[model samples]
Target: MTLDAPHAASRPTTSDELRAIALEQFASVGFAGTSLQQIADAAGFSKSSVLYHFASKEALLQDVITPAIDQLEVMLDRFAGASDPAKGRARFVDDFIDFLLRYRLEVHTFINQGQSLRGIPVIDRAGRLIVRLSETLCDETASTEDRLRLGIALGGAAYTLVAGATFFEDEIAPADEIRTALLTVVTELLAPVTVATGPRTDRNQKA
Candidate 1:
């Protein structure tokens, strides 16, 4: 992996270059294991120069995480704007599939190496962005209970699709197919529907 550089050897400066370097290092090496020096070196910059732009490695990860989160919000917001639940549900899976494919390393970092992710404290916001997205969409249509249940069921689809890849790729065979199937199920779960009565549990338990 290379370290981030100030500019690409006379090339114009842009966010893309730095972000590319970060993604490269992150993908080749786990986020927890990757260092600012490596990213800077990869981008052809000094370590301090990289720190000047990003402040720290954690900040760099935030830069990476921000896009996935933003993309998710935009998908949900656009779906809500579309005013079609079916389209919204399909969009949800499509968006999540892209996010999972693009950020395989980061997803692993989040699910497997949260402690090293620096700042924003994982426990507080592991799924906060998606949760907020769910609330926003649900408040519009799904009943409170259905929202809670479906959001969980569908969100599990996204997380499990990614996680199942890492944990079961060999056993699953043609992991991409499994991921697609997972996304399909997730999309179906997201569609507005009548849920049957189910068991209830105490709300006080902190998950």
Candidate 2:
């Protein structure tokens, strides 16, 4: 998704131009792989000009991903206040789908390359949010096996969406239809088990 144009002022600041360029570069090569000079060149400014606006590449990355991280925190807070757990989970998924799609590049960076930035506040907050989401899927009372399943389901959905975004870009179905289909699968995956299953017998022993 296209980010909004820089705020209308007499002219856009060098900082704004650098941020836009850094975001694009970060999305392409990730934080560890990008450099200040590359960002400056991309923005048609010298390294000193870029440094005037930001101290270092880390600072640039923090600014790049901060907005997306804050929005996610807000969604988590909103869903936390809900009375129904199931509905809340569904709402979180819908919001998350949109968030992922909108910030796919950032999501891709964090998921695939965030190890380089571990312990950073924003990355840590995102980690905690993911853990909380798994808890939300299956509370402490859930059996270990059930919790494992929920965790895998949640992780799989995220990886699939971020990794397969390109394939879905040229879709045959409408956006809503694709979203509904994914949500249905995730909801079913998280459904509580009501009946125990018996051990399977050999096919040769079947009645």
Candidate 3:
């Protein structure tokens, strides 16, 4: 099951097919701009069919964000379980950027319409989830302030990575370089020994 695109067949994965189309449209047109009819047409389904799969547009967005958040949770869980702080931190930072890179469309779409998206509630819920994941990944080594800083760094990294990918897509030799650049910048700035700044709310979101 590739997350890259929708492959509609006789497969009993109508939900997945709907989600795949939703994701593509969301990336192309954003949460507000995308229409159920457009998605249904692209997916070879009627608007009512898409509605049957997902009750509403909000529900479809929820479904899309859920998997992306789940991916973050699983990766952060791995980061928390790592034995070495250095490697763990690296993995965490890299994984953070990698998640954004892999889901650049969703991340960009969410961030761009956060004000409207926040009205949906699950948008902020997703933020809290990421913060929770960061808290665990930061663990005992980081104070409340440190965790927030780390989270902000990840958010900033996401923005930079997406913009970088967009700006340099044609100029860059390869697509993966955007993520590599983000990992380098994040790893360098995320040193635990560095003097901490004020509270990074992005990292230490309440449990």
Better of 1 and 3 by TM-score: 3
TM-score of each: 0.55, 0.69, 0.67
Off by over 4 Å in 1: 1-53, 107-128, 136-166, 169-176, 191-207
Highest TM-score among the candidates is held by which one? 2
lDDT of 1 at 136: 57
Q: What would the C-alpha RMSD of candidate 3 be, to one decimal place?
A: 7.3
Candidate 1's residue-wise lDDT over 45-95, tens digit each? 888788777888767777766666566567766767867776765777687
lDDT of each: 0.63, 0.72, 0.72
- Residues 1-207 of candidate 2 have per-residue lDDT tens digits of 234444444466787788888977886677777899999988899999989889988788888788887887788787888898778877877787677667766666665566677987767766776677676656556665666667555556555665564666654356687577777776676766643346535689958
What residue runs in model 2 are displaced by over 4 Å at the alpha carbon? 1-13, 141-207
Ranking by TM-score: 2, 3, 1
State, as a TM-score between 0 and 1, how close model 3 is to the true structure: 0.67
List, in order, the clash count of every candidate structure.
14, 0, 3
